[model samples]
Target: MRFARAIALGAVTAVTGGLLAAVPAAAQATGAPAASAAATVSVTLTGKAVRADGRAVDEVGVFVVPAARWVDEDAAPVSTALVADNGRYSVTASVAAGSSLYVRVDDWTSSDGYMDRLFVGKGGKAAFTYVGLAPIAAKAGTIELGTATAPKLSTVRVTTSAPVHCAKLLRKNGTLAAMECDYTVDKKVFTFTGMYPGEYTVGAMWSSWTDARATVDVSAKKGVTTAAMLTLESPTTMTGVVQDTQGKALEGIAVWANGPDSPRTVTDATGRYAFKGLTAGSYVVDYSGASGMSSAYRDYVTRTSTVSVTSGRVTTAGSTLTKGAQVTGSVTPLAKETYGTIVALAADGHVLASDSYWSSDGKKRDFALHGLPTGTHTVVVQDAASGRYAKSTVVVSGTSARTVGALKPAAAPVTVRGTVEGTTAGFVSLRYGTSPLYRGAIDGGDVKPDGSYAITHVVPGIYALRSHRTTSTAGYEGNLLSVTVGDGVAVRRIPQPTRKVQTLQTLVRTSVTFDGRALPGVVPLPRRTPADLWGNWTNEKGVGQAPWTGRAWDAVVLEDVFFAYHSPYYFVVKSPTSVTKPGDLANVTVARVAGGPTV
Candidate 1:
């Protein structure tokens, strides 16, 4: 109970400091004595640290940070000892009667650091009362010692019934932790444990690697005795035949079992290939060459069908390696370049995964490229020889390919022009739309002084125009406009939509109160004036009423009664001698005051 009180006080200090200062004292009063009389408690703490493979971690630091306040005030150690070379650690501490205890184990230097609380006593009925590096307990049951045996270490042996060399192994950490564990080369298996109970991810490394996760839980009664067994059995084999476009066997052509972890296999002279040791999942079969030739082979050969690998089942995936058209072209500026290197770029602007070649010609200017996929590609003729060059897009089809004309130097100047509206003075932004987009500033033209602007020397192609407002102006308007231009095309401006404004009106009212004692001549109530009162008002009797209705007793009396009743009526006074007539009130003009339904 004293320990509990101390913990409560510590929690309070951790939160709203000093808010619960009185709670600890009150708690101690209700619980057992703060210190027991003439009793000494002995406690022992111990644990082990090891690699995932269960090998004891040697010379590791394992200590505890005390959580309780020392009753003696001066009985606290600054530090504790390191564990033995065999990964075992122990600490003993004595406590006075009624003292509380808590223990923590951790390492600060290792990549895999850990911190945990150690429970003492059978039911974990002890509490932390004093601050110290060694474990402490109030009773003899406060600390219990145990050993952490390293789990058995083993490698996973994967073998496909068929020939496959590209299988992968993935661990619970979500990484292709191991490449193809070819049973033929690395027959050793891998095993890991000493992990707390939980779900873990286990899968193959390649695209075909099946995602198989396992769960482990260790019970308290089991202590450090827990084990898990995982057996990764190979799925069915997929057999296939690969041939060239001419129907000849394509020997050494690599075939891949694709999915999550795509594995690869090589075809035999008989044009036959097999992917073994696969799981039950969708897989793609690809035909290519070994590492270096993969890019070119990928360009020429493609997958034919997806095969399903099931347990003890066989799937067939026959495919052909087409002989794609081979293209050959020569670079003209190889000799005059400094690095004397030429690079070929694909239509998508990606550098071909091929090596750069130097022109063998004496001119040091002529370079040739062969075995290119039949398509349109940009032939970049850099001055590898002269260190200066130009690029031109060329189309390649048949086995023979060549440039039709000499490469010309790139034009340095291009024109940019556009129409602007609503803007008086601000810069327009010009940028290229495609890859390697060029960004530059353009000055506003004199067209509308505040409107359309134009800039010169903009490279030909589609360009984006953005308007920027000056600091003094409000802000830019409209979205970016795209403009296209041909070589030597005139500057042109696309029209921008004009901005418009809308107006609205609503009738608002005001209230006015008048006391008969404050103004004798004024009406004591509200009324509605004739719609044409500003111009003129005529009575049915043909009498012309004054526009102001000034200080008129009849007018006031009539208006007050009309507003009070909210209806047309003949004026009548409470006096019994008073007489009211229609014509008498007709000459009295009334006007509507501000508030709704004045009465």
Candidate 2:
């Protein structure tokens, strides 16, 4: 298969010149178009195309493909460029901010034969070298990819026992590459050429058989084809019989295999139902359509009454349907609402069925839910307009209609107040449970500077008081505080998660003096060698500047602060240290004011 071919540039929208102001000067270098910026972020990739032996390569087609669409067959590059004879190339692509992009360098037409490499950044680390790893975060700047070494490409020959419908190759780093099955041949082979040297997982799918997956490693040389064999397993099967509690066969009962594909069928005259072509796994066999019979589920094999099918084997699960019960309830309108919705939920919180009631006068309306299996269910009644709701648990058994007395919906919502510790700048909302039938924030409030927040008009129910900090990225969620709100005012103190210290450093160019004195009212700074002077800093106020001959002295003064998130340097100050080189400041140390912003 052809790996690299000409791609049309029409798909890439042209960036406006006004957006070029944000492009770095390095992107405007010769042999490449001047970088332009617009509403979308732009990444300027600069790299050298070299052979494995480090020789400059010419005529190499370098492209930046969006990582999200890399597996697509017709995915086009956002930007493409050819390697200069000097091996250096630069390509700029306008992409969405924070988006990831893949850098691919290829020259399949060369006499060297399909030599290619995918740029994973320097030292093969996923770290951001201007742009981050695999999904290179689309930062609007230049990404200095020092060199891209095109080692001889390798191939992966994937084979399977059954006719493969499709296949996919997954890299160890979670990069997916689609592979085409060789249908013209035996249909069992999927050859992926021009693969980078690494560990890859090969997956093959068959129409009526269980799919297969195998891991293989492709070598780092040309003419080497890694062989991977995926032996397809036979599809699993589940057969069952549905009968009445009296041991009589129940014909025409729908037995549903609630597993992959959710295959369903009706029982024959013998009360036997079979479901084939299923993957090996646990299955929840359910039968519900029998007249007046209770719905049931078989989750295990043998005495457990459930089913789990294995490859080429059959698992049997027979269910005996009993008489189902019914539930009847009346919802009393707490306010002026005339209609309400009634829902019956299983113990697992799945809605069994829903029914509505309407009344011309503001009086109680009746509702009925039938065909409930022998189990515990929570019946809920909700006012359509006022958002008031009430729920009660009912036990359903036998054929009688269980009557739940009238349920009065809750009255007006309540006011909730709390002290939000740790962060003082975010919003506080409530995630209500289903009993209230309202999930969103009826009313959310911003945390005051004093760390107090109040949410008004909150419905009465169990809720999770969620807090967020908009101050910094280090902001984390406090432990979920489950609160039960009633008609009165509720108050609680929620402590936010602690903030971790992030070490930040920046190079500060200044003169250092060897005066054995410390600034007044300031504590002695941490003693360390000049090499270890770089630490966390918050701000810099230049005091003075003087020209020093010799090697320009760049002194690093480390300070700890709470406001620094982005940027390398935080705090800077000018002192009377006159040193030619960084080594001259071996005895120099700095001090910080007591209780100052920079500790």
Least lDDT summed over 10 consecutive residues: which range in candidate 1? 6-15
Please give the CA lDDT of all the candidate structures. Answer: 0.37, 0.50
What's the CA error at residue 574 for candidate 2, in Å? 38
Alpha-carbon error at 371 in model 2, in Å? 8.3
Clashes (backbone N, CA, C under 3 Å), per candidate, total: 53, 20
- Error in Å for residue 220 of model 1: 14
Summarize candidate 2's per-residue lDDT along 1-599 as a digit string, tens digits: 23322111111111133110112323321222212322477678777777766666653222343321112212455677878877798888877565545565554443453443333432322210112222344578887767666555567777776655566665322223445654322277777665544445566644223344434533323447778877665546677777766888866676655544456566766777666557777766656553212233211111113468887787777887665677887888766547767766665344455678877777878887766767787887777676677878899766667988898877565678988876677777775443222223345678898889998755555667767664322344455567877668999788864433222223333322211221111111222222223322111221112222233334433222211111111112234244454344333333211110100
Q: Over the stretch 211-242, how does candidate 1's per-residue lDDT look in tens digits?
A: 32322221111113223333444446677787
TM-score for predicted model 2 compared with the true structure: 0.34
How well does candidate 2 score on lDDT at residue 499? Answer: 39
